[model samples]
Target chain A: MSDELYDDLILDHYESPYHRGRLESASCEHTELNPLCGDRVQLQLQIDEERRIQQAYFEGEGCAISQAAASILCEHIEGRTLGEVEAFDARQMLDLLQVRLTATRQRCGLLGFKVLKTLAYAYDGTAGTSA
Target chain B: MENIRSDFPILGRPLADGTPLVYLDSGSSAQKPQVVIDALVECYQTYYANAHRGVYQFGVQIDEALEGARERIAAMLGAAEVEEVVFTSGTTMSINLVAQAWARMVLEEGDEVLVNEMEHHANLVPWQQVVRQTGAVLKHIPLTDDGHLDLDQLQNCLGPRTKLIAVTGMSNVLGTINPIGRLVEAAATVGARVLVDGAQSVPHAAINVQDPAIDFLAFSGHKLYGPSGIGVLYGRRELLEMMDPFLCGGNMISEVGLTESTWADLPAKFEAGTLPVAEAIALGTAVDYVTDIGFEQIGRIERALLVEAQTRLQEIPDLVIHGPDVDHKGAIISFTDPRVHPHDMAELLKRKGVALRAGHHCAMPLHARLGVVATTRVSLAVYNTSADIDVLIEAIHYARKVLRRD
Candidate 1:
């Protein structure tokens, strides 16, 4: 189980993250931090006139589960519509990771998803209306 | 030491997956010995009653046990009087008691409360809150690059308005043992009181609080190999008498009239309600257990283990230990490796049956000062042997190899 969680895919993403920087012309940006272990994530999005995510980038520091999840999330969300990204939830994020995680690690794995969802909500002007 | 380990049944048990457990997170909490466990069970099964309430035989016996625990704890601390020791829920509660009851009473606007950057949150946050309430300024004695307190700044930090100096006797993260005696002497120059947060020290060293320079000492039982929810706060007798009661209720009152009430005597004045009787008694037994072994022998064994652990930990490539030299540190070793995050290392070590603590260890400021988000910590207790250290080193090596894979 641990091997699957830290597989070559996840390690590769963690070692050489994709879209790991600030977006100079970001349409929306959001950041979140896990106070328990001091893990933090920032997601910046550049949305087109059609409300589609043209580009996604992230910057953060955390364990492999979180940092790799952020990298995977950035790769998954680029070019997707705001509606589609807004539909992404914790369960979907875990399924994307494709591994079992303890409740605590689940939070770590979903941090990027959370930041991206928040950015989508803010873009849609429906932030703080859902759980 | 092997016999001592035998006294703790949990040390002999295997992990859920049938791996032999190597418990090393004693800085968070220690494993209970069989005697402490038995004492708790016996108290609940037989002669169980609310202390200081009933006149029946059971109540009287329970009351005696409570007071006996107090006396034993006082003796262990080398306190001048039993009344000087107050029972609290834990170290956090003890520090809050002094912060609210003593510091709030004495501190005025513009007063200063000196602390250090290496303190755990329990010792640091309470003072911050107190200063916020009283308009007093809170100052910290910075740490040197090697993690020892910058004692040269002590003289400058103290002044007429310096009301208190709250410091940890030992650092839970860096394992640096501060010289409380010297701190007390420095604080005394300005008539400032010293509160030694002994949460990490009392369990590993023998402390004598009878010195006139010292004002208060606080420690929790769980860290001392006893039950949780039991802790001791030793305040100077005069200071305790002069301080107002923190929590006022039935047991802490001498007289009560609808709108106004008088408080009880020295110790009872602070103990407001029903105490944790069973935990206190078990903590008394824990004190006896440590006393029987003596700190001299415990210190010798722990020092040797610490030296070996430090040596082995230093061998790991890119591993940076964050603390003073082993000779000046206690039985804790915190380190960070650039290849592996502390949380990842901790998760990997747990799978290998090595229980270590990771993250800021409730010292975020210290972590920031050290320029890292988190670090893995291996804190030893009396039950931890060289074998456990070897296991920890092996697990670290395995984790590094797995994490650094291209």
Candidate 2:
């Protein structure tokens, strides 16, 4: 109910989330599973021939961090190169959230970025999911 | 002894919001006293070395300190042998070890393990894991409508295939103090081993493992006014000796060159690598502190708080207390305020300098059985006073007024 505990950017993103749904057709897709907290997210991306992200869409439910992170993330990475998207990490996400998270809650904030990064690596035709 | 309140330096400290901290989340993790903290600091500063390995002066000193801690814990639990104690990371890890070692070693396909519906995940998950690995069927002894384990149905649940029975000494979320002696006796009649999860029980009351003739007992230091990252698993020496080691590493191995190796004795076989030395030593001091004050006095102080809290909380309309029908529960109360969500209640209490835990309290089944999504829990320790209960009740009323406008 109060934005005091959340970052202003995160609160704004949560209040007015961007790219909050799935693309009709997508080139790459990823899902983040936080086993500890049971927070889950599935991300779908539509990319062009140049390997630049044309549209990034995510649809999932979790705590505020995951929702806001996914919303804020989609807004930031649209039309960006895969290399540029992989550069976003936990620190940047936490900075965007505008609040400090405990060791347990950090996974919630990092869920969206982790999924997207893995997808970015997949887009480059790289193997494995831990990107 | 000075006010006993002075023994906890953290109580004298202020919160980040400049409010005097009111900790009501002892059921989650108890706050440490000055004595426990000092004991830990002394152990690390003065006697810092691995246990049972080195022959040097510091190593010998550290070994004595660590063994001394184990002995104190054993004595506190009324264990017959010092060798019964095994130090672990926490109660979760301790229960996991029992599952890995005892259940995995002894249990086989067509065997069964019986647990209760009210058990915490720490008590429930390990049994599930063992059963999964061993091809054993895991069964639940049903809970009565009022939350007591149904002894009548428990007999039906037990049969020829029942290999083990694991249950909690006290419900962490519901605050019910189960009749573990009766449960152990029932399990023994079928020739099954019993493991008691004592994480919630140890701090609230005195426990005697010998009286119950319990096969194994496990508890965490942090839940008993000591440090985190430390727990004790006490198994009957004969049973422990029979079971294989859970973790095989440096300290657990007796001799290792290349292909062949011999394991250490009972307790050491389980404790591998660099243990939580500081936490173990602090646990000894915590035992001493509890003993000096006497368990009856501690129970009295807590019981008074519980009684007052129950009476005061009942006065609030639409407040439902979850647990057994009897008044013999532990010094903890889990309740749902119909007007407020538990998470919102916890957040509201946090702003008022009171710390409480919200959610299923790691006992989701119990919460589910009670027909509620979640509840806020207020657990007590020896340091808790009547004034603390008053503060909590006052805060709840404030939360209701502010948050419950529907």
Candidate 3:
């Protein structure tokens, strides 16, 4: 049922997204578009000398799944090291949402992780999981 | 409408969740009628042979069938010669043919190709390529606030260097039925050729290339209640004769030399390699089906549906229809609800089996012009009815309830 995807938790995050503004003095930044549906996501992360993600923020325009997932993923990775963020696979992203999305919605739910994957793919880190 | 609706079997089909298919995505691709399906089946079952390659029994029957289909389609388009209607993979290929073969040959540095943002990428991108390669400039005729083209500035846009005016007969996104005749006239004033992207127009409206003197027309069969992978590119005889062939292979050549190969005559000159044999033959049946019903009836049915859809959609608050009012547009209605994202609307609406397109509808530039990222699209066809709109409205309400704060 769609209710599973539109659960209160996801909706809560969508209505009030976390870490969803510009990050000044960002060490890493990337913008990606889910070309399949035209969702725009820009990720800005502040990493410390220890390679720990000091701050994570995202700004985007898209569906609830996309917005909500970005909120959750940013919060989840705020204090984590870059290695931990790269280790976070697509499965964890969907599980983090606590919902099983239909195939199309899966793309929406994974927009943030895709941006992360791009950072990993850019030789910033060795991404253990194919996001 | 019931009789016509029954001709398309997919309408009767229910999704896995047991919801009836309330298809509003005809603008993407229309559901095929039984007649078209039957023709496709019959061709494959009875005589499925490589086109223009065989001399056997199957070849003769298929050739006759294919040619008969082509002739009927040509007549339907009011084309002067049957040879003018060249079979293409789809509208995309048809437009690309002209872009590569004709535009590349004619355009020079400092030449201009006038176009508008409402045109699907299929039309705009090809001309952009033509301009980029030849150092020709691509210009836009600014769109009206109501989504129509601003014809007032056309004279200023037109000049001696304007080689072609690439415009859509109807916008795939805005649903605005452009005045092709006026555009064609304006192009003529500048000694420019006009290529009408008829992918959306030919299915809903009647057009005659001869009367308008349209230099090139491109449209898809799938949108016209026909099988996919078959489309038509109608070029003026004089223009086609002078242009180079786009694709080269076994069928498109007149004679092969050790170092040089001459192109075949019109029609065959463009069709290279083996064709989509069954789909092309079935497209004949699709044209016949539409012809027997006639454009007058098709227009009446679609206009009524459009009016009903527009009125109902207007009653809902916070929903902004992305195009002009129904009076100025075709049966397409694109809208965005501030309370719900279009992707969520489309996804939730599908739970009730209402299939609509949600995105820029392949007109990304138009979306940018509309000052929106995406809008949900609902397009009507001849087979659609008031009940289908009712279902769509109810589904929209359901989607809103699911996705919105209320």
B-chain TM-scores per prediction:
0.99, 0.97, 0.99
Put down candidate 3 lDDT per residue, B195-302, tens digits, no spaces. Answer: 999999999988899888899999999999999999999999999999888988989999999999999998999999998989998899999999899999999999
DockQ ranking from best candidate downward:
1, 3, 2
| TM-score of model 1 (CA atoms) | 0.98
Give the runs in model 3 whose Cα sits over 4 Å from its true position.
Answer: A120-131
What TM-score does each of the candidates earn?
A: 0.98, 0.79, 0.97
The digit string of per-residue lDDT tens for model 1 on B112-200 reads 99998999999999999999999999999989999999999888888999999999999999999998889888887899999999999
Q: Comparing to the true complex, what docking class would candidate 1 get?
A: medium
Candidate 1: regions farther than 4 A off:
A124-131
Q: After best superposition, candidate 3 residue B261: deviation in angstroms?
A: 1.9
Residue-level lDDT of model 3, residues A1-131, one tens digit each, is: 24756878888889998989998767777877887778888788777767788888999999888999989988998888877877889998889999888888888998988997776555343322212
Backbone clash pairs in model 2 (N, Cα, C under 3 Å; residues 3+ apart or in different chains), count: 0
Off by over 4 Å in 2: A1-131
As for DockQ, the candidate ahead, 1 or 3, is 1
- Please tell me what DockQ candidate 2 reaches: 0.08
Alpha-carbon deviation at B25 in model 1, angstroms: 0.4
DockQ, all models: 0.54, 0.08, 0.51
